[model samples]
Every structure is written in C-alpha cells, then in structure tokens.
Target: MTRSVYVTGVARGDGRQVVELGVMELLTRQVDRVGVYRPLVHDTPDRMVELLRSRYRLVQDPATVYGMGYEEAAALQAEQGQEALTARLVEGYLRVARDYETVLILGSDFAGTNLPAELGVNARLANECGASVVAVIGGRDQSAESVVAEVRNAHHAYTNLGCDVIAMVANRVGQGVAAEAAGALRATLDVPVYVLPEEPTLSAPTVSQIVDTLGARVLLGDEAGLARDALDFVIGGAMLPTFLPALTPGCVVVTPGDRADLIVGAMAAHSAGAPPIAGVLLTLDEKPPPHVLALAARLAPGTPVLAVPTLTFPTATELFTLDGKLGAGTPRKAETALGVFETHVDTAELTGRLSVARSERVTPMMFEHALIERARADRRRIVLPEGTEERILRAAEVLLRRGVCDLTLLGEPDAIRKKAGDLGISLDHESVQMIDPQTSPLRERFAERYARLRAHRGVSYELAYDVVADVSYFGTLMVEQGLADGMVSGAVHSTAATIRPAFEIIKTRPGAAIVSSVFFMCLADKVLVYGDCAVNPDPDAEQLADIAVQAAGTAARFGVEPRVAMLSYSTGTSGTGADVDKVRAATGLVRERRPDLMVEGPIQYDAAVSPSVAATKLPDSEVAGRATVLVFPDLNTGNNTYKAVQRSAGAVAVGPVLQGLRKPVNDLSRGALVQDIVNTVAITAIQAQGGDGDRPDAGGDGQERTEGGAA
Candidate 1:
C-alpha cells in the first residue's frame, strides 16, 4: 500500500513549504522511491513540484503530479457540485500511488481561489485519497491564545471530516509566543503539535526576490550578494553618522539613490563587520552619480546595491508584504529551513506516525546523505590545518553552505584571506573561524603541554615550541584542548606529517592496541567497508583479530550491518599455507571472544560477496558471499585490492578514515579534492559524536580495541 501524507495549510501565508521540504527530506532518508501529487496547482507549472523533483531526485512525471489547475478545479467544483472535482483528484492520486512506495500529496494554497470553504475542501480531498493530514496553521500575526485555538480547531475540523489528522503545525509565530502557543496546543490536543518559531532568514526577502518583485535595477553587486537575506528594513532619512549605527547584520538599507554619503557609509560598515547589511535599496529610482557609484564598488565590491522606483514610504509598505520562498536559487534558505524544522519538529515521531517502512538496502547516496544529516544534527567543530589551500577553503564554503559543521581554519589570516579572495571564494562569513597558529595566545600553553606529554620521549621545551608553531600540531592541540571537536589535514602534506601529531599527542584510546583505517567503497548499488588498507603494513593473529573486531564496530557505526569476511587465497579447507594459518587463527580468536559477530575466515574473494560463489563453496555459512565487511590478511594485499576495485569499478572510496583515537583526528590524502575534504570532515564529526573512541586500559584492560569495522 502507498502511504500518503497531505501537507495543507489552514490559511494563506502559512509558510507550509518549509514543512513540505522537511518532510520530503525525511521521506528520502527512509524510503528509496517517493512521489509527489498536487491536487490543485498554479496554472504555470507548479514551482514547488519542480523544486521537489530536482532536490529529491523524484522520478514522477510532472504531468502526473498535479490533478488540475486552481481555476479549472474551482469551475468544475462549482458546476458539477464538488463530486466531479473529488473524483478527478482521486484518479490522479491513484496513478501516483501505483508507482511509488510513498506519496507526498501537496494540498492547495488557501489563497487565489474562488472555491468556498478551502479547509473543508482540503479535508475532503485528504479523506478521499486515504491519506493522513499534517495541517499547517499560520501564526504570523496571531496571539498565543489565538494560535492555539486555531490549531485545535483545525485538527477537529480535519478529523470531523473523516481525515486522519496525524500532526498539527503552528508555523511563523512571533519569537516570544511560539513556545507558549505550542505548549498550550499540546496540552489540549491529542496529536503531535509542532511549533516553529519565526526565522527572520526564512521570512526575509532576498535581494533577487526583492529585485524581481519590485522591478529594481542592480547597479553594483554579485550573484552571491543578491542571494543575501534582507532581515530588517531601516529607512535612511537621517544623516550618515546617525544612520550608520542603525544598520544591523542582514538588514537592508532603504534610502534615496542620491544619498551618496549614506550609501558609502553603509558599505564601509559592512566591510568593517559592524553589522553587515544584506544590501542597500535606493528609492525614487535615483542612482548614485558615476564617481560616487565607482567609489561604492571599491568599498564593498560584492555587496548588493539596488535601486527601486517607489519612494521610501511606499517601498517600506511593499517590503512588509514580501516573504521568502523556497526555490531552486535559494539553497541557503533551504538549509536554514531544514535546520529550523529539524531542531523544532520531532521528525522521528512524525515518520513513525506516517508509517513509512525503512529501507533494507543502504545505497551509496543514502550513506552520503546520512553522513551530512547526522553531522548537522549535533553540529561539531572541526578544524582544517591546511587553511591556505584553495581546496580546503572551497570545501569549507560548501560545508558552511550546507550547515554540515562549524569550521575553524588554521593558517596566517592574511594569507588565507588573500588566497580565498584570489580563488573567488568568500570566507568573510561568520561561520568560518580563522586563526594564525604562530600568533595565537594558546601557542605557549600548547607548547608547554606538548613538552610535558613528550618529556619521557626526550623532548625539550624549545623543541616543543618549534613544533607547536606547525599547523598540523597546532590543529591537533586544538582538538586535545576541546577548542574543536575534530581535525582534518594532509591535502598538501604527507600522511605521516598529518598522523604523526595525532599519534604523538592524542595517542591511542584506552584499551586500543593500535590505530587502523577504513575506506567506504561506495559502489553503484551499495556501500562496502574495507579496513586496515591504509595504516597497517602487517599483522599477526592478535592484531589481525583486533583489526577485524574494530572493522566490524566501524561498519556498525555507519549504517552497514557487519558480516565480516577474513580474506585469503584459500576457501575453508581447500588450501593450506602460512598466511592461511594466520587467517584461520584470527577467525578462531574472533569467534571465541565476540561470539555475537558474524565472521568467516580462510575465504577467497569470489566467495565472500557473490551469493552464487558462496552456494557452490560454503552454502551453509552466514558470512560467505554476502559479506558487508572485508578484512584483508596483510597491508600489501588490502591496499592493492581496494585500489584495484576503486579504479576498475569506478567506486568512490571515501576514506582511510582513521579509527581508535581518543578524539577524532582524521588524515586526508595529499591529493585530496574539495569533496574529499568535505567527506573526511563529516566522517570526523560523526566519529567525534560517537563519544571517545574505545581506549586501552593499563595492565590488561579487557575491553576490545578494534580500529575499523567492515560490514
């Protein structure tokens, strides 16, 4: 059966698109195939449906997504008495239901329709489609008591009309009243009530949106600046000194275009970071003189400066009516909307209520999406040592844009800024934290601490000071001191230079015998775990067993279910050699210690992942031919095999993600790309969230210290 969710609004301007986007994200995370159906769409090809299709990669046809346009539906309902309209909607929805596992039905907006009782029409359509309803109530201008009453009434209205009202959402309420309204509704309502506080960014008009709405001309600004959110509007009628102080971060300045002094002052303030304004809106259709405008460009090269025809008073009135929308161009708004929705709404509970089945197979896309979503859930701070590298700065932009994690870039601040500027990358945003490793106040303290930790290894204070000046060592110290949750390096440095600091300062977690690595080989269909391929050169029975155990744990930490295959040339008792003996011993040790693990050994590569091969060789084995985790016997074999598979099969090998550290400090390849850095940073953040990787205890700590787990 195709489970459907009807996202409808009780009134106009409810900002239900945010909820719709959020629900779509949750649906994609769980189920593989999701379809969208809109009962009544705008005449000119629904923009919302297009956004959903492109973002979620939906396969549903656009023609099939909508039943009919609003005017057509209204005329049909009026002429045929609503029965014909209901039948038309049901037929369209059934076609979508037949093709997808889950269908997200977008109800009509309650504005711009001649139909009577819009709420009742939505309720009737939901009931006829056999769909559960998530009603959105706009609280933009309502009081706490009124918002609660409206939500309660909407729920009853839907339920009374024989629709399954799964949840009630109070969206866009005032900041002070949002929580109180939510509490009041939850106390009175039986269903899950989610209250979203008003996000100024989501409501703020973007420069592009304003330009489109007001028919304004852009005199000097870049595309990135046009996408900035206009959070507040300050009418510029005062002198430059008086008005400069009124400008706030993300606020748009409304002034006459002839006021050159105010425009220059506003641009200067943005450069100084004294509350960076979104843009300056020139009124009365006047533009700055040529020389003044030329000087304005030098002060803030990319800051949006627009000129609108309306005067200041009328412009302010029109600005009040402007609101943000989620479209293809506004990706940052989408991120902010998702962040806000995820923070305020109980998505797990909502998913459960919808009864969408969880997918059994974890696709590579799903794995990457899960990594990003998990990192965003509890945002951790990750520091990049190679801040001056263009790849690092570019990846930081992508990470910050996606709201993946908080980033701190370590290098000379001037050099980093200049490099980023030359690359056309914007690093002046507040999300990035830039620091000079040598000039930081923590340098002396970190040097003293390093000297103490390495005193027994024959290190003096002077030598420690020199090492502390290094970027890699300084980043590691930040992680150790809890200034950042994790660190990623080696885009331009050797792997040894990256891992040496972690090994010396961070050391191995208590109880861990050694550190190991894994590569998430993302195949076309699924993701497989390959372990100890990068770090370990050779291992005896004990270290090999530890590696397998760690590999299994690592696999499980990711979504992979660990069914480990200890690889060798032999299949069971088919061959005998020194290497085969070691594999057999490690298998026995793993079985004896962790009885719960599904592990197999003395297995050939062909028999481990191919079911047909397993049926011929070892049909009764659980781990054979369907293994998710592959453990290699030696470093030479493991490294070569993984590389061969990666190059030959065109797999995206995500790691060499180091494991079994007290804190998460991952080393990147010297040839790492921008996306590689992003992926490694996400993995490091997830590792940090796993809470202090397993440690080794002194004098025989019984805890297992496995490095990477393969499923």
Candidate 2:
C-alpha cells in the first residue's frame, strides 16, 4: 500500500503551507519517490502545486496532481452527493498513489470553496484515500488556552470522521503563547501537537508581489531585487532628511511621482547600505525624469523601482492584503518557511508516526539539504577572507538566512559596507561580524604569535606585522588561535595565497603525510569523490597511499561510503609500467595499513564506475564498479578526467576541497558561484566539527558523519 499524508487546515489563515512545505522536505529526505496530490484545487494550474513540483522536482503530471476544481467539487457535492465528489477525488489519488512510494495529499483551502463543511470534507477525503491526517488550526488573535482548545477540537473532528490523525499543529500563534498552547494541547490530546509561532518575515510580501498587485511597471531591478521581502512600507510625504530616517531594512518607499527628492534619497540610502529598502513605489502614475531614474540606477543598480497608477493612500491600503508566498519564484521564502518549520516541528517524532522509510539513494537536493541541517546541528563559526567581494557577500546572505553557521567576514568594515551598499545587500554587522585586520585589537597579538612561530626561519617582527595584515593570514591566525572554527578563502586570490598561511601556521595533522585535494562530482542521482585532483601533481607511492587514506577519510566525513579505487592506465597487472607500479604499491600500502577498508588497485575508469565493464575486467573485486572514492594516479589524470566527466555528464564539481590540513581551511575557485561558496563554507564548518583528534580514517571506525562536499 502507498503510505500517504493529508495536510488539512481547520480554518482560513491557518498558515498550512508552511506545514506542507515542511512535510515535503521531510518526505524527500526520507523517501526517494514522493508525489503530491490535491483533492480539490481552485484552478487547473495551482500555484502551490507548481511550487511543490518545481521545488521537489516532481515528475507527476499536472493533470494527475489534482482531481477537480473546487467549484466543480462543490457543485457535485451540492447536486449529486458527497460520495460522488469523493469518488472522483479517490480515483485521481489512487492513480497517483500507484506510482509513488509516498503521496502528500494537499487538502482544500477553506477560503474559496463553497462546500457545506470544509473540515468535514477534508476528513472524508482523508478517510477515503486511507491517508493519515495532520490538522492545522489557526492561533492568530486567540488566547493560549483557546488555541489549545481549537487544536484539540480539530484532532477530534478528524478522528471522529475515521481519519487517523497523526499530528495537530497550532500555527500562527502569538509570540508568547506558542509554548503554553503546545503544553496545554499535550495535556488535553494524546496526539502530537506542534506549535509554530507567527513569523512576519514568512508572511511579509515581496516587491514582486506588490508590483503584481498594483499593476506597477518595474523601472529597475533584476529578479533578485524583485524577490526581496517588503517587511515594512514607508510613505514618503516629508522632506529628504525626514523620509530617509523612516526607511527600514526591506521597507518599500511609497511616494507621489513628482517626489524625485524622496526617490533619490531612498536610492542613496540603499546605496550607502544604511537600510536596504525593498523598492520604491511611485504612486499617481507619476515617474521621475529620465536623469533621476538613471541616477537611481547608478546609486543602487538592481534595487527595484516601481511605478503604479494608484495613489499613495489607496496603494498603502491594498498593501495589507499582499503577503509572501512559498512559490518557485520566491525561493528565499521557501527556505525561511522550511527553517521556521524545522525549528518548531519535532521531525524525528513525526517521522516515526508517518513511518516513512529511508531512501536507498541520496538525491542531490537531499544531499544539499542534509549538509545545511548537519552544519546547523553543531553550529561553528567560519571566517571568509574575501568578504568584500560581491559573490562572497551574496553567499553570506544565503548562509545566514539558512542558519548554516556563524560567519565572521574578514575585511575593512567601511569597504565591505560600501561594496554591499553598491550591490544593494543589507548585511547586519551585528549578525555577521566584519573586522578590519589592520585595526583589530588582535593585530599585534597575531603578529607577535606569527613572529614567535617563525623565529626558527629568521622571520623579523616587522615582516610578521605586515604579513598579519593580509586577510588570508589574519583569518588563518584566527582559526589557529581558536577565534574562529575554520576558514574559506581564495575567491579572488590564488590557491597558494589562500592555503599558504595555513601551511605556515596550522601545519599538517599528526599522522597525515601531505595536503591533498578532492572534488565532489555531483551527478544527477549521486555524488562521487575524486581525489588528489587539485594538489600533488606527481605523488610517489608513499604520498599516493597517504592521499588515498586522506581522501577516503574525507569521503567518510561527508557520508559517502568509501570504496577506494586506485586508478592507473593498467588494470590488475594487465599492463606494467612506472605509473602502474606506483598505483599497485599504494594499493598494497592501504590494504596493509587499513585492512577494514574496501579497496581495489590499478583500475581503468570505465571498469571502476560501470558494472558491466567491472564484470568483464575484475569480477571478484569488491570496490571495482561501486567505488565511491577514486584515487587518481596523478594530478594530470585526475584533473582532466574530472573536468571531462563534469562537462560531458553535466555534473556539479563542488571542490578541490583541500584535505590533510591541521585545521579546517578550504579554498574556492576565483569564479565560484554564490552557491558554490556557500557549499564550501558549510563543508569547512563540518570539517571543523570533525577535527583531527581521532582521524576517523586512521581510527579504522568507518563511520560516516554527514552528506556534504569533499573533505
């Protein structure tokens, strides 16, 4: 039988979408094939369904996702019979259920439907589909006791209708009452009751949503600016000085068309990064002159500027109805929604109730999600040396928003703020520390320490003081002194410049022979580890063995079961040469040292990854075709092979994550994307947590910590 979960709300404005998104996140983490079905949607192409489809990469056809429109279902229930309405829904649901391991049945939104009893209808549909129920009750404008009573009543309603109520959620409760409500509900009901406090950021409308509601023209801004949340709205009727003070972070400025002064001031304030205004709304169909608009663009290149025909007064009134949505276009809200939901809901307990089986293969989305979750479990502070770069700041916003880790961006405070202002990014210095290495109180201390450490190499105090001013050196010093957990740099600098500080100060771990690098080749279905690709151009047999051990440890740390494959031109003595002999010696060293490890030697690429090729080439080898960690014979083969496979197969090569460092320090490519930086930082943080004390590979434990990038 296809196990299914029905997410239903007892009242309007219950904020059930967060619960749905949370459930979907949990389901995808647990099962490989999960489908979404709506018993009665308002339209053929529903926004929520599309959001789920895009976010989860669902393959279910749109026609099969919904049974009928709400109006049609209402008509059938009113004219024919309730059973007739449910029969059609059941038929569509069963068809979807047949193909998926689990189905998330989206219950009707009680707002637009004219059904006689919405909750009763939901209960009947859940019962008919043989699905478990997760009832959502509104807690807005209610007392804690009242919210608790409402949830208990909702649970009873579903249970009385023969629907198995797995959980009762009290959503959108006031700030102080969520705990009390959950406590009260637990005393009254036997079912699990989760309380989610009201999150304004999740409900705040985006600039794009406001533009759509007002039929406004987008004068300036890219998709990123349009997606920014409008947390507050400021009406610009006063002078420039007065209006500038009214601007808040993520606020939309509303003013008449002739108020070019207000427009310029708002744009200037955003450019200065004082408070990032969401956008400017020019009312009364009024627009500034061409020169003013061009100046605004220069001030804040991608800040959204909108023009609407509606005047300020009525437009402000209409803004109250526009709220943020969890959709494809607004992915940040989805992240916020999931974060809020995961923070509040007891997912482990809920998972047990749902009986969702663990998946066999970890998908790419699942891998990324797991990385974030695991990093958040034991949060660590990570330092980024190239903090003033645009990609770095953008990636910082994403990392902080997702609650991945505590970030300390090392740069000149004013310069970083100015760059962020030019890019229209509001980075809260309080939340993310911004330090100038030259002016820091620890500057002299770091210089003295560096001078002492390098005294044997005849380093002078003057040189140490100047070198400590470099952000890379300063960041690595922070990690060495335990001021920060780890460091990620090299977005603009060379790889040598980034890790040179680490090598000089932190040094290699006790048993590690040398520093090597690995790139996580993220294919569509799975992630594989390719080692020694970025470092050690021509490692000898001893160095290669150490590289294999470190690469296998890196793979295990990131949740890839390490089946090490030593690659060369020859396979199992089919040919003999210097390179082949070196690989064979490295394989022997690994087996003699770590007998518990599954390893194979001198295998060709095809035979290492393809089962058919492995059967013909090395049939009895345990790590032949199922190798998760591939140790290249040298850097040239590793680098070229990884690039070829990446380009040809459309794989996401995540690293060149440096392994065998004493402390966790990784470098990014100069052209790394925002997401790539975020992943590297997360990997660095996790590596900090899995320190060099035990050295999981050398310990021979074979334990996997998480699902993430190389090293």
| TM-score of each prediction | 0.84, 0.94
lDDT of all the models against the reference? 0.84, 0.85
Tens digit of per-residue lDDT, candidate 1, span 182-211: 878888988999999888778887889999
lDDT of 1: 0.84
Every candidate's CA RMSD:
4.9, 4.0
Error of 2 at 202 (Å): 1.3
Model 2 regions lying over 4 Å from their true place:
414-426, 429-431, 693-711
Per-residue lDDT for 398 in model 1? 71
For residue 52, give model 1's deviation from the true position in Å.
Answer: 2.5
Lowest lDDT 10-mer window, candidate 2? 701-710
For model 1, give the 10-residue run with minimal summed lDDT.
Answer: 695-704
Which lDDT tens digits does candidate 2 get at residues 1-711?
799999998878888999999998888888888999998887768888888999888888787898898888888998999888888889999999999999999998888688898888889889888899998988988999899778877777788889899998888899998888878888888888899999887889888888887889999888778877888999999998777888888889989989999999998888777776888999999878999999999998888999989878999999977877777877777777877787888878998999888877877777776777788888889999998998998888778767788889888887797676555455764558998998999899999999997897888889999999999999999988888888999889887788778778776777787878898888877889998887677889998999899889889889899999999888898999888999999999999888999999999988899999999999999999899999998888888898898889988788778877767889887878887898888888788886643222232211111112221
